[model samples]
Target: MNPQASAQRGSFRHRLVRKKRMANSNEHNAAGYLFIAPWLIGFFLLTLWPIVRSFYLSFTEYSLLEDPTWVGLGNYSEILFKDELFRTSLGVTFTFVVFSVPVKLFCSLMVAMALNKSIRGINFYRTAIYFPSLIGGSIAVSVLWRNMFDLNGYINHVLGWFHIKGVGWLTNPDTSLGTLVLLNAWQFGSTMVIFLAGLKQIPQDLYESAAVDGAGKVRRFFNITLPMLSPVMFFNLVLGVIGSFQMFTSAFVITNGGPVNSTYMYALFLFEKAFKNYQMGYASALAWILLVIIAALTAINFLMSKYWVFYESEGGRAK
Candidate 1:
């Protein structure tokens, strides 16, 4: 056989093998897309379309009963300039975030540290503590919380033992917001779980070394645990801030944003505009404003995180 012919035959076979592999790769890709088609369709139809539609609706005058008329920035202008309720709601939301996020994070970290210890039935204790998170956001729980804080309710009954008379927690203007903040703290179970997971990742040797260096518990926690936990704390802080800004269920069901609108949260305001007044356009604008506020805060958090979020792998603050 000619050497040239042999080379030509080998080249042809190589091309054929390459073509076969390419065909198989294409088939695999097609099958993968087919498997994810449902998710893609659901995302577009249920999630993305609504988001786009709402953004479009935000620039119009929509009352749900009438066809939406294009108003450009009219809705946003009105909400920003003419809406007193919007300002009140925004102020209330800011206050809620300021009070709730720190309290929730502190409670979560404290509870997580306590539960991180090894003891008999520790698992049971963790489960019991975490169980509230499963049902914490439900309407039933909000109603129960309302009743518990009522003037003649469970909280007052409990306080009576100590001769401390309870005020109308959800009804008073001064205390209504505080009650909601307390409720937000009560839902710290999920945050505690995240903190606990982060705590577990920290090396035991670090604590032992600190102890050997004559560091007391307070000093050790501030110097060791906090730096190690800073990354987790940053994560929880961002989530807590976002969630607190959108807080609604308890405020709506418990206080109804009442007592001179003292607890008139942004979410409750958005809900009332969209549903009660059927002002979809105004509501959409409010929603976008809230989104921007959250985005701004999250961006600030990311920018500031480099100063505090110490990554163990990086051996210092995250770059």
Candidate 2:
């Protein structure tokens, strides 16, 4: 072949190879997207679209029966300035989050520490402990809780064995919210599992070294275990706070936001407004307010974490 012809033929072959590789890459990308299309569609339609719509509706006045009328912060103004129930619900929700999150995290961590040990039937124990979380938030469980806390229910009947008169746990405003907090703390199984995983990840050498230095079990836990587990703790804390703030099922099904609305969670209030009263716009406003509150609280947690949440990658506290 002539030298110019040979060069031209080689160039054409190189371009053809490149084009074929590009086509294969595009095909792979398309297939990957096709596999995830369902998730993407559900996320946009079910999650993101509702979020955007709710934000728009927050500024309007709408009952389900009629079209939404733009009211320009009227809903927000009423909620902030005019709604006593809003304040009560906000306080109750905050109280629940404050009381439940720490106790639940602590109980979960304590149980996790115990379960981390090598023992007979450990697998069975772990499974048993975790089973509660799987059904904790279900309507069935909420109904069960309601029944158990009733004035003459199983819980009070059990207390009768000790000759202790059962207080009206679900009836009295003083103890109504406390009962929910206890219920929340009781469902610490998922957090326990996470803590167990984190505990396993801590190096055995750290504990051994601490012991060599005459560190007691408590000392080692404080010095070696907790710092190492700080990242996991931080994760659980944020999630627990967010989850507690959005508590609804128990309040709705069990307490019905009753005992003088003492257990009226912010979520339950928003639900009542939207569903029962048909105040869709007002409910949307409440929802947006909650979203902002959760976001702000999470941001605060992140900001504060730098001082406390230790990561091994940073050699101690996270930067």
Candidate 3:
């Protein structure tokens, strides 16, 4: 072959090979997108779209039966100014979050500390302690709680054995919310597991060194264990606050926000407005308010974490 012809043929072959490789790369990219398409579609339709639509609905007057009519900030105004139930529910929810989150965290940490020991049947103990959390939020559990706390139920029966009178737990306004808080604290299993995981990550040398320094178990825990577990504690605190704010099922199924709305959680109020009263617009406003509250609290937690959440990478100081 002539030299010029040979050069042209070689160049054409190189271009063809490059084009083939480019096509294969495009095909792989398309396949990857196809694999993730379901999740993308669900996120847009089920999550993102509802969030946007709810925000829009919050500004309108809409019952399920009627077309939405723009009401500007009327719903928000009514909720803030005219609604006594709104304030009551908000207070109740805040109380629940304040009491339940800390109690649950403390109880979970204590149980986790016990479970972290090298005792016999430790796996079984862990499972037994964790089992309640798995089913604690279920309707069946709520029903059981209601029966247990009833005036003449098993709790009162047990009290009778000691000649002690049992107060109406889920009946009186004073004790009703406390029952829910106790229920929440009892289901500390998941938090316990997280604490256990954090405990396992602490270096044994740290404990040994503290012991060698004539430090007691309590001193070592304060100097070593707590600092190492601060990140996990912060994680659980944020999650617990968020979860407590959204508490609904227990109040709904157990107390039904009864005894003068004492146990009326903000979420329960929102549900009643949307579904029972058919005031979808007001409910949407309440929902958005809840979202804002959760976001703000989470942001504050993150900010405050810099003061308390110790990190080993930062030499045991929060960054």
Candidate 4:
């Protein structure tokens, strides 16, 4: 063949291959979209759309029964400046977060340490410990908790067996919040599992070396185990804070914001504003305010994590 004809033939073959490649890419893209279509549909319809609509509605006064009336900053102004219940609920939520997160984390960590041991019947023990987390937030547990804290419930009944008078745990303002905190603490099963996993990842050689250096259990935990587990602890701390802040079911079912509003969580307050009083706009505003609070706290955790959270991959130096 002539030289020009040879070059032309080569160019034609290149274009043919490019077209075939493009066709395969298109097929793959179509298949991927097909596979993900359900998730995409649910995300937009169930999650994203509702989020955007609620944000828009936050500035409007709407009863679900009527067209939304735009109110600009009126709802926010009222929540921040005029609403006494908002402040009370926020205080209660803050108190819960402060108490519940630490207690839950402590219980989780201690239980995790216990479960990390190579003991007989360990699997059964894990299942038993973790079972409560599966139904910890359910209405059933909340109702049971309500009865258990009632003046004549199982807890008081048991106390009576000891010849001790059981005060009204859920009815007294001083003790109502404590019951909720204890309930929250009881749900440490999930956190404990995560902590157990983290514990398994820690190198036993480190503990052995610490023991060689005359470090007791307490010192080894503080210097070696704690430093090694700091990243996991940071993760658990952030999650605990967020979850405690949003606790609703227990307070709603057990206390109903009673006992002088001692257990009035922010979520319960939002629920009443939206469902009970039909203040949809107010509730939306409250939701966004909650988002901002959670975001700010999460940001703070991330910022402070640099000081404490240790990673082994930071070039042999603490990160």
Candidate 5:
């Protein structure tokens, strides 16, 4: 073949290859967008729109049936001063978050660590540990929790064997919040699974190297495991705090936020305002306030994490 003709043929083949690669890239991009479109639309319609409307409604007195009356900061003022129950609810919610988040995160991390072993029947163990989270917050589970904490319940039944006197786990105001905190702590399976996945991602060579350096298990965990797992820990911590702050279903079902309103969480307060008292606008304001508080707390956590949360690539350097 002539040299010029051969060169022209090669150029044509290269152009065709480039065109095919471009077409394949466009196809992948289209598919990626298509896969995410449903979630995007759902977020805009159900989440984004409601959030925007709620913020507006926070400044208005809007019964569902009637037009919203502009109330400016009246709702905020009432909540801040006039409403004693609101203050109590805030205190209860804060207490719940303060106690539950750390306990739940710790429990989750421990369980995850236990599960991150080369044991036989690992899947079975995982399933058993995770089963509680699956049925958690259900009406049946709440009923069981109520019974388990009741006077002369299974807990008391077991305590009798040990000759320990039964304390009111759910009935007494002093004990009710603690019972709810325990319940919250028990459902750490989802966080545990997340942690386990994070643990699995850590290279085994690091642990081996640490062992070679004569670091004990505790030292390795503190120096290597915790640092490598910090991102997941941070995620679980933030989520646990948010979930604890919004705790309502268990309190509603088990105690009805009763025993002197000891278990009255913020979401329960909002529910009572919106549905029981027909104060949708006030409830919306509370919801927005809760959102602001959560956002602030999460932001603080993220900022503080820079000091302690070790990344894998951080080379064991303390911030």
Candidate 6:
């Protein structure tokens, strides 16, 4: 064939192939959208709609049975100035978050670090540590916690061995919050798993090099491991703080928010207002307040992370 004829034939074939490829690409894109359509629809309906509705309801008096009444900032003013329980609940929740998040993160990070080392029966140890988190927030676990903290329960029984008399863990206002804080700390396995994943992602070469430079385990941990794991630590810290702020199930089941509302978290307060007292408007306001608090705290965390959290690309060499 002549060169011109050959060139024309090649161009025709290339155009046909391109057209066929484009047609296949369109079919694949359509199929991907079809696969995700249900999820998109459900997300919009269930999550987005409810969020928008809640934001709207926060500005109104919206009882379940009655039409919403435009209340402006009345709910906020009422809760801020008049409602004593709101302040108390917020105080309790803040205390819990402050105590629980740090303690839980520490416990989880320690456990993860231990598990990261070569040890006998490691799988068994990991399973044992992780099992508690699985059942930590269950009704059955709550019930068990209630019993264990009761005056005459197993805690006292164990205390008898040390000749130490047990105080009221669940009943005493001073001790009740402490008991829940401990419970929250004990369920550190989920965070531990995340830390373990972060640890595994850390290259062994970093540690080996640190060791070569005569850095002890503690030195290496402070200098290398902690900085490298800061991202995961920050993630768990935020989640733990949020979860602690909304703590309800344990308090609800174990203490019912008291001997004197000592263990009442924000979620329990909101629940009581919404359902038990039938103060839906007040509860919605409380929910919005909680969201604002969480958002503020999360924002603060992100801001502080800029100072403390060392990402790999941010002049921190992760081997």
Count clashing pairs, candidate 1.
0
What digit string (tens of lDDT, one per residue) describes model 6 on residues 257-303?
89798988889989988898876667788888888889999999999
Q: What is the Cα-based TM-score of model 6?
A: 0.89
lDDT tens readout by residue for model 1, 1-319 = 9999999998888567545334444667778889999999999999999899999999998997889999999999999999999999999999999999999899889999999898789889888888878888999999898889889998999999999988988889999999888878888899999999999988898899989999999998999899999999999999999989988888888888999999999999999999999999889989999999999999999999998888877865343
- What local distance difference test score does each model get? 0.91, 0.92, 0.93, 0.92, 0.89, 0.89
What residue pairs are clashing in model 3? none
For every candidate, C-alpha RMSD to the true structure in Å: 9.4, 9.1, 9.8, 9.6, 7.5, 8.1
Clashing pairs in 2: none
Clashes of each: 0, 0, 0, 0, 0, 0
lDDT of 3 by residue, 200-247 (tens): 988888889889999998998898889889999999999999999999
Model 4 poorest 10 in a row by lDDT:
17-26
**Which runs in model 6 stand beyond 4 Å of their true positions?**
1-29
User: What tens-digit string does per-residue lDDT give for candidate 2 at 7-70?
Assistant: 9997888567545334444667778889999999999999999999999999998987789999
Q: What are the clashing pairs of model 1?
A: none
The window of 10 residues in a row where model 2 has the poorest summed lDDT is: 17-26
lDDT of 1 at 35: 97
Q: Once model 2 is optimally superposed onto the true structure by TM-score, how far is the C-alpha of residue 91 displaced, in angstroms? A: 0.5
Two-way lDDT contest, 1 vs 6, winner: 1
Off by over 4 Å in 5: 1-37, 313-319
Backbone clashes, candidate 3: 0
